[model samples]
Target: MVPASTSDPVPAPSPRPQQEDRDRSSRRRQRSAVILSAACWVSVVAAVVVFLGSGKPAQVTDVAGAITAAGIVTGLVGTDLLLLMLVLAARIPWVDRTFGPDVTMNLHRRLGKPAVYLILGHGALLTVGYSLRDGLSLWHQTLSIYSGGDMLLALLGSCLLVLVVVTSLVAVRRALAYEAWHAIHLVSYAAILVALPHQFSAGRVLAETSPQGVYWICLHIFAFGSIAWFRVAAPLFATDAHQLRVARVETLGPDVFSIHLSGRDLSRLHVRGGQYAIWRFWSRGTWWHAHPISFSAVPTDTGIRVTVRASGAGTRRLAGLRPGTRVSFAGPYGVFTAATRTAPRLAIVAGGIGITPVRALLEDRDLGPGETTVILRATDRSHAFLWDEVRALVRAQGGTVIEMLGGRAAGAPSWMSAAAAHGQATIHSLLPDLHASDLFVCGPAAWTRLVVHDARAAGLPDGRIHVENFTG
Candidate 1:
């Protein structure tokens, strides 16, 4: 185990207030998750109820009738899932505050394919069912259906949904540029709109004058309204009001640099240390791409800082940004902060460039002396960009900073340096009081998972372990 560096180890103040705050935050997050999840399931169940109550189920007499009934049910549930997916992607304040943007996006991704599959099932089942009922072939039935009514629009919507889901697959997504992928994703809105006409006009259960029709209309309004306000209007308003611009760019290492931004009343953004913002640098070279980057330092009255590693074409262009380049941003988002702390003492594990947020968290004025133990990891000294800054901050707080330097081991417990792996170092060995401390880990996704696994194996409760991966 690496030795801790502390000038003077003193006992911390009573954490009664902090504990109470954590308790409140935990309750709030839990309540939000429960309410949102229940609402989604209720919507799905309500869709099924509307279908059954409309006398659609009783009309089934043959195999063809059964297939048609199944198609109707699938359509209702699939549309509901689509609306829910839209809401999750809306980035509403309550949702972001509770689960953070990463969790929200992850949920959004998980729902996409299933929603598309159900929609496709609805289409295929209806085609076969109708064709069989009319004693016609599937191809002839499809041609007849698409030749009239809103079926063509429905077909177009289904195709768009398929395209969106296909592009989202891991291999396909990795092959496309972010900008191209995002543009394709935005096509989902058009898909939803085009698919709506057939649901209200062609479908019996949700006909214009039906009660279920009103409910479906309200659902659309709610989903689109949230996206309109939070994802679009709010960010636009914040950009205009703040009038942020690049003050300077400072190189911290080979391909890592910090962008210092000056703005009007920056403190009003209410950005916590470990939270991030979706930023668009309005420069000729970089305005097309938006970045989700963490704050490397706490905001002052008129300024804030975000550090970025030039890992891709978009970020590499950021390194060339000149002073006075305008910036527009979406948020001060995330839950990986001091506010999420549940224990009196803190154990922070940060690797590579993930140290940016950890650096900012350490600078929090609320941090008490001897209340933190930080472990910073890197492949080599050159990769440890903010080590000195972290060390200084921890030292001033009367806390300890343990540096884990060297190439990672080629085998099991691969998150640690080869030397530490050889010496059999583990999470419990590095942070002896880990059970009593909130373990905040941020790093590469795979490495972060390993650290979290070790923390859990050491019997630390799941709630006490917070993670933010630097996969971006």
Candidate 2:
């Protein structure tokens, strides 16, 4: 059963829980993000410091030396950026908690091109420097570098890096299936492995005895170790701990269903309401694809539920899942939970299939009577996946549930329904206390943005608005 029900009204609280608790969690997340962001910048500055302290700048007496020094600095900064990318993509719980999964992955993607450019600059600068040093052509110098020491492996690593970056480009990425794209992305790990040996063998600056060398070695250890632990080992441990399997599947509407998962010690997953997990069902048709789906209901010790829409081939196969089909997941990720609350009241806006996480949020026990308001938008009654459950929960909590049904009205705010738009309804009109409440928006990307724009236009602080778009 869902955590909240119409049959059981929430017991009224005395003046609500102290607002300080909510403020404390918000401050903690902000502090954590600041500390983590500072550390990244410090690491980059230290890399440049290490390069400068090597006396390389003083040694740059000629054009060749200047180019060589430039190459080394670029290489150092580039490597630091690449490692930062890995750590962001590692899905470390602390990082995810601080930055949210969407922000973290977005940062990861943003760094890819610059990291590639810097690495390429390192190679190009080094090539020109060496060519000038030996009075050889760029081609001959390139051949010489490739033939010497660990340069061959470095060259191979560069090629792999290029491939990974190219495949990640939006145009290229969209052309390929997720499985194919993911397979190529995994090659980045191999690239890092192949690229690493060259650092010590080809450059003395990172020799084991130096302070710079020790710093870099530890950084590499931390970066790769985080990926191994959080991305690989942690998920494996969660899978083993829960041993999750499909207990049942209930059809909610056309193309929409809820997968009920049964597992051992499920509460150990520490899932927060409004968070999602990347699920991989161990079935012939669905095993190869992993989906990020929000929890439809909060978890108990033995069970959890995730709602899914058959929008693609991978998700369509979820309809055929049998009871006891093995399931493994890698989350409880995202920060769209009660812990993010920054205000005395909670306001939620969800559209179409986006209601899943909102359903889970409304079930949260901390939400007291008269402290929650939900606006669920859909084109029609059928499109409103779990509105009834949401309305029931809201009613029990002594809150409000507003339904917006119909397609968009022409020349109206894109996020609003025809009637609501025509009535001149806005976020402020619908949510009078928006400025004094934490607004959580979940829906299709464009529509979510429009809702967010309306909230912002209504003078809501950015920090007071939390969003989870359906698209990556």
Candidate 3:
């Protein structure tokens, strides 16, 4: 458990292997999703083409036939794609915990572009196919079938697509306030509702005339139902409407505060040590918005505790909160945990308020005698929140805490230099035998990158290093 010096410059963690693994996994999932989506669409299109090309004579009965055919195909494909998007969004939290939210957001943006394109194509095909068949204006054709209910649904669906496109655009989202954008985005559910019935009634392959129509209809209904429940209903119900109340607010330092929350009716929030929650202070005017904060304390009989530093607007608001303030927590999400990886030695690095999660990890009883070392970097020793608490906890756990004050420190400190020199010293001593140890970092992105880089350069495997981002 070698102690790192404040002055000892650590290299940036090598990103090659970690990045490669992440990229490879992302590619595999994307490929699988794309292939599945493509196959489903191709099958639907082939069925439509076959039905149209069959010996059955073309019937120009009304605009309904063309609209129905196009709607059927488009709805099938569009719905599946939407389902995939929901699944991806649900799984994204875990990915973000592993690779950082920036990476997850980038993937979300890329994947969404294709989904928007598919939706546009679906709309275009429906309009053109119906307009050509009726010899009427697009608007008139749409209105003509309004009495049948499908047209009304289609209009609503179109509106939803427009919302999705507008909100999804980076420029538009940036221009609009986050709250406004998020509110408009919530209309997505309404769009799904509007498009659903029309899809069921007008779909070709799922219609009564087709051989496997009944089966397909049942399958689609089941899939859509399940998706709706998992993606929306379950989450809403998971936490009771009664917002969490702040049981305690302890100021660990000048800008850092630890908020302890408890609610009589709140359900148990299952979460690992290194996870975070998006907390919304219900007393605030804008209760709809939530900000992510790492958990500084593990779950106990009382409730959950989150240690927050007043870095920005949301956090500042939180810092001002007094005891008994009502709040809503949206998650205990992220995959970073002590149980996920294995190593002979464990090194934890944290910067500023990022020590919250690291504190939780150190406090975990499950982590046995694995030669643990914690390095807390701050502008000054006084700026280190919970410094004494962390040191005490580490001492009790038989781990070591290396507090690096930001100013010029007396020749790098004898203990730090000794630890860096040997690498593999016991918790009491500073020395170098620490090579090949597992490293866990939670801090500002720059500090995390630096510590991780140094650890890797010192001969640590990619899998031996784990990092969690608190900023994003």
Candidate 4:
């Protein structure tokens, strides 16, 4: 591992064939990720098969009976989707490694509204279907559902689920404090609990011997068991084994600082460069919030370092933390490292504090001369933190570095400055071997997306482009 503040030169890289082999391993992981995601959908499809093959529906004696029967099918499908959502959000390690934390989280986000919509449709259709059958008004039918066994609790659960989804919406989530929002979101467990009784009581399909019943029971056990083992148990065990504590803290630039931590057998954590951890400091004003931070330096036998910029109250409190404050982490998550590389050559484009992980990536291993290239982006010269140290490291490896300063070129959609974009400063310009090199980008969401667009326009394949955005 490199020192916290250093201008020392780097050594040469390892062999090319080794990197190629690592790339192949990454492709295998990608395939596994696809297979796992497909399995989730397959499970949903199987539930539908059980419903149809079991002879569970009415004989269509009348129009009202048919409507009510369709309602049952919708309810079954909705419940299955909700279960899948829980499994996806369980933070299973293999799933996180295969798809990346960001990719999995994005997938988890996409499933939210669809699952909730299905559930809402299930409730409304059932109300209408039952009303027609009983010769009751729609309002009376809803009242009827509430009056039945476990029906009131199930209704409450549905309402709570709706509130959880509403609070998770982008605009509303932004307005609430993270802690406040998390508290409300935890109510989802109660929602699931309250809704379970009705499924057993109201089922013709979910009897003990039914395939549907057996599958759902196993699914619920697996989902909650995964959360227990990976999310809760594993973190607690790692925290105790590491016994991590702050050893030193140093200010790097305005609002930015590096935290040096000491712990037992640190490297065994298996954290890679360009990956991040959710850090919780055991201290007043800091312990409640877990900040996602990247390692600024590689982990050593006894210590590690993470760079943080004070962008929020949680982070601002981090800057004031004292030595010996205990720490716990929940990651080493992300696939932005060289293990995901697909080419012999490497190119890095870093924006502002995004340089933290990029710096670690550079130091992760030795780089052969001419094997790497870098383009450092900043609003201006003063905002270019850690440039001196980076330049020294790149010079040691015979790599190239381009410092692009200022906003978008001519206020256009380019990531380079106006003068640079007009000249030889596009993605192709900086990385002459653009299509052949693995490009790693880290930055604010919008800026990173623009750079990725430029890379795609230059004909870089999806597999060769790696990106990390600070936003969740």
Per lDDT, the best of the predicted structures is: 1
lDDT preference between candidates 1 and 4, better one: 1
Candidate 3: lDDT over CA atoms? 0.61
Compared with the true structure, the alpha-carbon lDDT of candidate 2 equals 0.86
Q: How many clashes does the backbone of model 1 have?
A: 0
What 10-residue stretch in candidate 1 is worst by lDDT?
A: 1-10
Q: What clash pairs does model 2 have? A: none
lDDT of each: 0.87, 0.86, 0.61, 0.80
Q: Please, what are the lDDT tens digits per residue for candidate 2 over residues 1-472?
A: 0111223333333455557888888889999999998998999999999778766699889999999989988888988899998999999989999989999999888888888889999999999999999999999999999985688888898899899999998999999998999999999889878888888788754566677888898889999999999888989998998889999999999899999999989888888889999899999999989899999899999999999988888999999999999998898899998888888888899998899999998886456777777888888888888888898888877887777888888874578887777676777778776777899999888999999998888899999999999952
- TM-score, every prediction: 0.95, 0.95, 0.67, 0.91
Compared with the true structure, model 3 gives a TM-score of 0.67
lDDT of 1 by residue, 1-472 (tens): 4434445455764666767887887787789889977887899999898777766699899999999889988988999999999999998878888777878889988989889999999999999999989999999998998886787899999999999999999999999998999999999989998987787667743465566777788888999999999999999999999999999999988899999999998889888889899999999979999999999999998999999988898999999999999999999888899887778889999999999999998887466767788989888888888788888998887887888888877756568888887787777887877878999999889989999988988899988999999874
Better of 1 and 3 by TM-score: 1
Rank by lDDT, highest first: 1, 2, 4, 3
Clashing pairs in 1: none
Each candidate's number of clashing pairs is 0, 0, 15, 3
- For residues 182-268, write the lDDT of model 4, one tens digit per residue: 889878768877888887786544446777778778877887787777777888899899999999889887788899999999889
Candidates sorted by TM-score, best first: 1, 2, 4, 3
Better of 1 and 3 by lDDT: 1
